[model samples]
Every structure is written in structure tokens, then in C-alpha cells.
Target: MNWILLIIAGLFEVGFATCLGKAKEATGNSALFWMIGFFVCLSISMFLLYRATLTLPIGTAYAVWTGIGAVGTVLVGVFIFKEPATFWRIFFLTTLIGSIAGLKFVSN
Candidate 1:
């Protein structure tokens, strides 16, 4: 379904973001590889987002896509990058998830 594709696209958005973070930490060949990963993920994410927009409302799809990316990237930061998962961060994340789900529920 398009919604599924939208979710996958959102996940790829997270992939690109993670790649950027890794690329920043890397050097030389490693950094180049990470950048390559970033571009590849970016391409796939964009393509799938376009595809999902065929049937889904653009506003809802975009919001859900960015919401997924934001939630995923934040979790990645907390777990992989060891970034602090403060109370406010977690609270907002939960609200974002609820909003995304609500969009899906309300959409056609």
C-alpha cells in the first residue's frame, strides 16, 4: 500500500540522517562511503515519497514522513550516538508518534 511505502520512505529518511551523522564522524574513505549511503538513501526516500503522494494527501503524507524520520533519528541518536534521552525529548517523541498515528487513522 501507499501508506506502507510512505513508512518505508520515512525510514529511509532516517537512514540518510544516520549516514550523515556517521559521515561526520568518519574520515577519508569511510566518510566517502557514508556520504554515498546518504545519497542512496535520500534517492530512495524521495522516490517512495513521490509514489505515496499519488494517492495520499500530500500534507498528511509529508507530515507522517517527517514525523517518522524525526522519531527514528532521535531514537538512533539516543541509542547509537549516546545522546541524552531527556524527559522532554521522550515526552515530545511520544506525542509525535500519537499524532502520526492519528493522521493515518483520519486519512482516506
Candidate 2:
């Protein structure tokens, strides 16, 4: 259950990151809306992450959280923002996913 919460938190991290980018691109009321979304998601992500940490090791939980968020954000960039999906980017993303999996495997 803690792992599930951690994963959900990571997904929220991705959402907040995307909201931040949107907020940066927007202006006036649009920017305010995005900023509000960003704060909401950020708060939820942090809360879930804190809950997960009550049971999981801090270092491992943090790394996994960031890894999931990084991967999800990069994918969002490539798909939604039309960012380049270079070979090296995909390779390193795969490596990060592998490392995250390894961390989960090693954790009790």
C-alpha cells in the first residue's frame, strides 16, 4: 500500500511539473489557473510522499519518486509539447526505469 501511494505521488509530481510548464507559458487568468492546478497537485504529491516515507526508507523512496516523475514528465514533454525524442533520451529513460525497478526489487 505504501508503494502504491508512492507511485501515485510520483504521478502527481508529473502532473504538477506539467502544470508548472503550462503556467510559465500562460499569461493573465490562464496563468493563474495553471498555477492553482500546480499547487493542488504539488500538495497532494508531497502529502502522499510523506505518508509513504513513514514506512519506506527515505533515500529509496525519494529516488523512486523522482525517477517516476522524471520519466513521466519527459514522456509528457515528448508527446504533448512536441519535444524531441532522441535515441539517447530514450536510452537513458530506460536506464532510469531499470534502476527504479531494481530499487523496488531490492526493497523489502
TM-score of each prediction: 0.99, 0.98
Worst 10 residues of 2 by lDDT: 74-83
- Stretches of candidate 2 off by over 4 Å are none
RMSD of each predicted structure? 0.4, 0.5
CA RMSD (A), model 1: 0.4
- How does model 2 score by TM-score? 0.98
Clashing pairs for predicted structure model 2, backbone only:
none
For model 1, the run of ten residues with the poorest summed lDDT: 99-108
Best by TM-score: 1
